[model samples]
Target: MSNTISVTLTVNGKRQTITAASDTPLLWVLREELKLTGTKFGCGVGQCGACTVHLNGEPTQSCLHALKDVNGKTVTTIEGLSPDSSHPLQKAWLVEQVPQCGYCQSGQIMRAAGLLKQNPRPTREQIVEYMSPNICRCGTYVRIASAIERAARETGAQS
Candidate 1:
């Protein structure tokens, strides 16, 4: 008898099906099965936000979500942020030069996008407080905050 079960997920606006152990984390499924490597794995325990992705427009730690839990749910990885890196956040990230080592950047951007979706005009303090959990070893918090603010401003203007 096989212990693996099939799960279908909507990721980055596409549907994918994979067979794996029920306990398999969404991080591995995204990276291994779907080949969406933009969502990095930092701390498997979810203390780090390297594996952040949007689940139904909410920032969620992929490392903490299991394959079974995400079945039938919509997930948006970094690739889904824009077709050509044209999302306001991506553009602002470039303008602000928010990446150093770049490992944690995708999660940072995803988390920021979620924040902006919820609160289009977050104050600097609110941005800092919400983003505090996403660890960036390169210490790019200032740049990250700047990019998020820039993106928020741009997004707000367009709305």
Candidate 2:
């Protein structure tokens, strides 16, 4: 008997059905099964935020969520953030030049997107607190914060 089970969930605004072991982590599901590789896998233990994704519109560590846990739920990877990389954060990220090595950028951007959704104009302190979980080994923290602030300012004006 196969312990694997089928799970159906919405990813990047599309419904997808996949079969895998119940205990499989969502990070693997997104990368391997769904071919959504933007959500990185920095650490399997979730200490790092490189696997962050939006689950039901909340920033969640994909490495910590199992396939069974996310069944029927909605997940948004970096690809879903914007159809043409036009999300304010994306634009600001470029203007601010947030990435160095670029490995952790997608996760960082996803986390920042969640923060903005909750608080469109977060102060530097709030941005630091909210983004503390995601690590950028390239030491681009300043640029990351700047981009978030820029995105917040730009989005706030539109709202």
| Candidate of highest lDDT | 2
Name the candidate that leads on TM-score. 2
Residue range 1-159, candidate 1, lDDT tens digits: 336889888888888888999889999998998888999999899898999999988998999988878889999999999999999999999999889999999999999999988899999999999998799998999999999999988988898
Worst 10 residues of 2 by lDDT: 1-10
Location of the lowest summed lDDT over 10 successive residues in candidate 1:
1-10
Candidate 2 structure lDDT: 0.94
Candidate 2 residue spans exceeding 4 A from truth: none
TM-score of each: 0.96, 0.97
Error of 2 at 57 (Å): 0.4
Off by over 4 Å in 1: none
In order, candidate lDDTs are 0.92, 0.94
lDDT value, residue 148 of candidate 1: 92
Summarize candidate 2's per-residue lDDT along 1-159 as a digit string, tens digits: 338989999999999998999989999999999888999999889888999999999998999998888889999999999999999999999999889999999999999999999998899999999999998899999999999999999988997
